[model samples]
Target: MEIILWIGFYFLTFYAFLPALVSRIFGFRVFTKGRSDSGIALTFDDGPDPEYTPKMLDLLKRHGAKATFFVVGENAEKYPEIVARIHEEGHILGIHNYVHHMNWFMRPSTVKRQIDQTSDLIKRITGTRPLYYRPPWGILNVFDYANLGYLQIVLWTSLFGDWRKKIGPDKLYRRMKQKLKPGQVFLLHDCGSTFGADRDAPANTLSALTKILDDGKEKGYRFIGIDEMIAVTEQAKKKNKSRQAAKGSEARGQEERVAERKSSIGPIKKIVVSLWMLWEKLFHVLFKLRPVGDAHFFNYRVRRYSGPPLDLRNDRTLRSGDHIMEIHFENQMLFEMGMKSKTSLQLAIRIIREIEKTLPDLARELAVVPKGDQVKALYGVSMIHRGSEGLGFETFELPKGLFARLTNVYLRFLIRVIHPTGNQRVREHSDTLNPRMLIMERNTLLEWADESRPNRRPNRERPVESSL
Candidate 1:
């Protein structure tokens, strides 16, 4: 019996406690907080209370603030009018399970059913299914990661013990006030009827939240929904990445200028590169490109294509307005590599290795996006036309039009900017440096991910030159 009890303890630890610890400590497979400059996300749980929820809504409306409410399924079903009101008011709704129970105590299937039921209920009431979920108490089981891929699991950056009535409004306000900075996800309770919670605790929460909302407004903070907060965080990350890229380019340019003091065109080249980097920044901002996983070598943005139809290999044709993930090489990274390499061939080999390392990460990142599966192909135009077929890409000549001509000029300029010998290399290889479209269908990309193949050198028979 002693041995059996030990086995059960170990099993429970592995099955639940370990996973919960990983998620809480490292935020694995969970969105704990956001990165934004001017947005604050206020999220409430155990909500839709008959008395307190309406008051909270009224206070929020008066302050012109938006929030996210993770409502218990049972409570939401009972007071659906409150749920409807929440939707109508443009506040985000998230699932908080059917009851106030710990996820560690539930089976994987049971957790999935709870989420599905709650999501269906929300859809029926608000005509929109909720995409975000917060497990009760932010606990997780081992299977939660595998089972909940379709839903984004949210945690919080700040949690005050507002569910206890004795804390009162004054103390709660002070605690919440300390976390009033941008990009904070505040976890507060709006319904306090659960076990170990004071039933009237939410009354104090409401009172404290009213003051916090007014203070946040007066401080010029935008109280936004969690969805908007996530979007803003992504935009912030892109902006930071652009700035970092510009700094890197500047550093590289300075190093080159110092090394080649005899070259009178160095300062002029640096100015041109700075202007080019500014254009890249503007392009990223306009297109909203996202980095693939944590890899800075590649960024992509999904956009509707309005170009001419192109036939693909699998009896499929991509027509105008089809969604495609347009891929862009991180220009600074390429420029740095070129500055470090001795020749265009050496730079091309280094770029190939970097792509091999980053493609799998890009595949995994795309797999999680909501519209990722719907995208037709990964597409880009580059002067790196040679040896692309060896990397599972189909190459095509750009159509003769204004867009094609502009792309040709832009890519040729990029190659010169990133080449080790700059204009000398371009003059030597100008005939072969024209831009061409490189495309890999979604299915082929997924196959690469599924195989998880080891990186290999490109075919040596082909010219190993690329301006990626």
Candidate 2:
């Protein structure tokens, strides 16, 4: 009976108690995901050790790749310069806790102290605090994660269990290579896995890195930091959130404006002016631009994703000084007063004519599609105006056309002078875009103005007689 009870106790520890302990201690969280279709994350934990970090940094430099090292507080203090070197080389250093203790064995105070001390040391060395944390031996606890909300909880998708010496480098390398995939965060150790003793595993880790690098190159994988991965993911989330908020806000706002238009003049103008001013402030904050004239533009600076076309040179030898302006207006009254009652169709024709005159060759290459069937449908463009003077443009969809690639170039003047809300539709569409402008040396609008005058004969004759 005694033997049987002992056996049952062991089984309970393994099956029930251990897993529950593990789950509670290491609250389930993924550090990095879906940041890159072609990028892999190389993460090191329980490190900043002298025996290996310098060499690893050297190897990474040779390969021209960056890795994130999760340094133990004690180790970072021992080799502050080595940690500094990691930062100087453009790599990332994240916290692996100070003492590298097991959470289940540690008190809450100890865990907090360990995290804080190590973070302070890293900051003192690198000038920027780490925003990512990896638990020693993958033993993360719920309280740990909750307390460390500022840091991301990183868990490995593939690891060689490389701290064990028994595993040969070949096996370790093969295991890692086979499991590697785009968007995977791989776990490797710099000094050794926190789990002590297993001779083959630790050395094999460094050995495996060379092969991992080569194999990843073969597979077209790029490597990025955990912070970068999480940032991109967060941005996508924020954009979606912002978009939803914008749609709801705009829809409700429009309805309110319509209702008020039928009822009151007393408060509506103030409301419009307030809304316009708010958007202007938002744009200024987001893009750091103060509008000039009646022209206001918002620029999106997206990192990590492929950006829009950057070439600003006049295509097809169009003179540098030539300029063209295309204005989009929802109100016919404003549109007419701004440009002498010119219809959108007529304006487009006149602008196209100016382009042809500036660069006759491009004119020959240009295929002007008929009015009703624009070469491609334009992206959905909306103008929101709450009152007579409050107006702004929101762009969402892109119409497919030959001009799609060049649309960003020609779009500067068309953006309305209005305040901007973080419109989700616009953010989602413009996520990977960059700020750009096209220069036409001679302002096409000016040329067209001169051409639009009928003959200029009677006024010219009167001026000449006065001069004589």
Question: What C-alpha lDDT values do all the predictions have?
Answer: 0.81, 0.54
**Over all chains combined, what TM-score does candidate 2 have?**
0.46
Question: What is every candidate's alpha-carbon RMSD to the true fold?
Answer: 22.5, 21.1
Error of 2 at 439 (Å): 69
Which whole-number lDDT from 0 to 100 does residue 317 have in model 2?
A: 30
Instruction: Give lDDT tens digits, candidate 1, residues 18-99.
Output: 7876786557888877887778999999988998899889989998999999999999999999999999999999999988
Question: TM-score for each prediction?
Answer: 0.54, 0.46
lDDT of 2 by residue, 1-468 (tens): 999999988865654445434553233454534445677888887777777788788888888878889898988898999999999998888888888777656766788888889889999999999888876766754467567868876776556567777767876776676556776688887876355845234567878888888888888887777777667667768887888677887777765664544353346544654565555444444543311111112111111212232222123232222222222222222222223212333443333332223332211111211121111111112222111111111122343455555664323222221112112323454544432222222222122224455641111222111000
Lowest lDDT sum, 10 consecutive residues, model 2, at: 385-394
Off by over 4 Å in 1: 249-468
- Top candidate on TM-score is 1
